[model samples]
Target: MIEFWLCAGLLLLTALAFVLIPVLRGRKLQAEEDRTALNVTLYQERLQDLQAQNAAGALNAEQLAAGRDEAARELLADTEGAQALPPQRTLGIKVPLVFALLMPLLGYGLYQHWGAIDDVERARTFADQPKTIEEMTARLEAAVKSDPKSAESWYFLGRTYMAQERAADAAQAFERAIEVAGRAPELLGQWAQALYFAGGKQWTPQLQALTDEALKADPAEVTSLGLLGIAAYESGQFKQAIGHWQQLVAVLPAEDPSRQAIQGGIDRAREQLGEPVEEAAVSAGPGLTVQVALADDLQAKVQPGDAVFIFARAVSGPPMPLAVKRLTVADLPAEVRLSDSDAMMPQLKISGFEQVQLVARISRSGNATAGEWVGSSLPLASKTTEPQQLLIDSADSKAP
Candidate 1:
């Protein structure tokens, strides 16, 4: 918000500066013209002298005519010499023209290139969305299997473990990645976050060292800012937290999710320290949970944390689409249940499911990309029944 206001203020001031310069220049020119009055005086004196000379017969008709022409030329030069000095720039015209034409175009070009408003928002949504431990672990295993040398995969796996509240596992993953990746700023940031989470809410020397490393690599790192701010707040350094968050807000765009997220955190810290919070509660909206499992036949080969997508279609009548759930391996269970009870489950009449199909597949990322189909597409008698089970064999899982 402050950054936006500052840019807007600068643009406005530039516009005014352009507007007033021409007006002042024009007024100065007019005042000079009025004060000098040299043209009028010179022309009158020349005309009177010529008339007297002509009357005294000291000048012939030709002489009088030539003298009159000379006087006229001198008068013209005095009156028009200032016009030849230089052309004055008119801000009244140019300023509005530039603002009208270039402002919108320049603003649009800038937005199209570096203004990652929507892209950042989408990434934020992905980041904030919940993932089960099984799903994350499956992804990590697959990533490692595919490319054992990828430090980024290891770092992500560590971060994922941290998300699942498995701090020790996360730390180990981060450590391994650091050994291979070697001091990447983003990796350091994630490593520090994991260390802090594992350290029982106290800043350990190791964690502080990682934090310092991350900040040194990139002072504007968002994760670093968040971690540092939290540390400051916890240590009763409310003002320090505010300063970090304030700097973050300045760097982030006006519509950035992190901007709001960090600002809210800062406000809460301030309020806790007896300072006024500038915002109200932010609503994150409703959430849903879904589970997918492979059939019993496929259990030996199917991993729990594999990624899967579940689709349910009504069996009878028009054969309408019923529901679709995307899930990861960590979310799978021996028996899968779909009902209104799950927090993430969407609202359905709960009576429309005639037949349900389950499939398990291994995605390119080492996670379950698909689910094996179970039972026939035949019509079901009721929606609410015992939980459905889909089984797949281990041998089949490795098959193409």
Candidate 2:
């Protein structure tokens, strides 16, 4: 900030020079004009004295003429450069001097009204990585203070508050972000999570509304799903917890590091439900192979680029898929296998379900739950090894 102000001062000085240099030059020219007038007055007086001397018989005509010529020569010498000087316009001099005096003030006023000085200061503050959480929090606090409308700053500040375990403060920060950036699903989820933690893990109607709003906008919002799972687990709603965590697991990428932790949560929830935990190390167990194909009548209804989801769900258990695979319509008639390795949740494997149903759905919108066409297989043993045929021949009546 000091450096910024120093640079601004230098520029201000440069601008003043442009306005003031002309005013100074104008003063010098005015002084030269005054001197030229003085020299002319002296020359006229000398000429008058010479003429009087000649008329009074003190000198002859030739001598008087010689005196006048000497006066004329002296006047010419004094005013030699006066004619070359551009005519001094008093009209412009005062106005420029006034403008020079006011330029700095005007510039400062305009900058105060419209300049991004605070942003510059904030940028300088953030140039270096903060060494501590407290330092980072302080910087973010200052940033939001300087730029209250900056949604990004508010978001970071909220995250930093959460890191510092100031849940209530984090909730406020997230709320500010939502206000400034509109109620984005991610921000809504964060706000709900913060409020949940701030209230001592107590679920409230407000929190429910916030989470519902977020999930409604984006069903796969990870933060909201995770938060709901945590709240359900704490409230002795193990089934609900499992449902939420399973959704989260399904949306997370296969390589995401957080998937392990979420799976751990799901396992814990399952334990609370007294579900038998398989003691043996789960490996690639017997998987069901299914060949999926689009129906001939529906060929014109779906694009080749549409997503097709193939999965196995328990016949009478939770609705979440045990294993799933995704492909495009162009890959119709493709053979895919569903095994424990493709499980959405670590504890929810196809091998755990005695009877499962195979499902194939073609969704132009890429949503697994909702699609334009779907096909299903009758209740079959999870250990079925032979390849089964599936056809997307029916309209997706379950799709909303």
Please name the candidate that would achieve the greatest TM-score relative to the true structure. 2
Candidate 1: global Cα-lDDT? 0.59
lDDT of 2 by residue, 94-150 (tens): 787788788889988999999989888887898875544466778889999988999
Query: Candidate 1's residue-wise lDDT over 1-400, tens digit each?
Result: 4565578668866866675666677778766665446677878898999999999999999999999999898777767655533545445555565665666577668877878544444344335322444654675666665556767667777855664457888888888898888987777877788778788778888877887888898887776777888888888888988888777677665544235456667888878888777754332111112234445655565566655544344443222223334455566553333332221222232343444343334443433222343222234344334444443323334333
The 10 consecutive residues of candidate 2 with the worst lDDT sum are: 276-285
TM-scores of the candidates are 0.38, 0.65
In order, what lDDT does every prediction score? 0.59, 0.84
How many clashes in each candidate?
33, 0
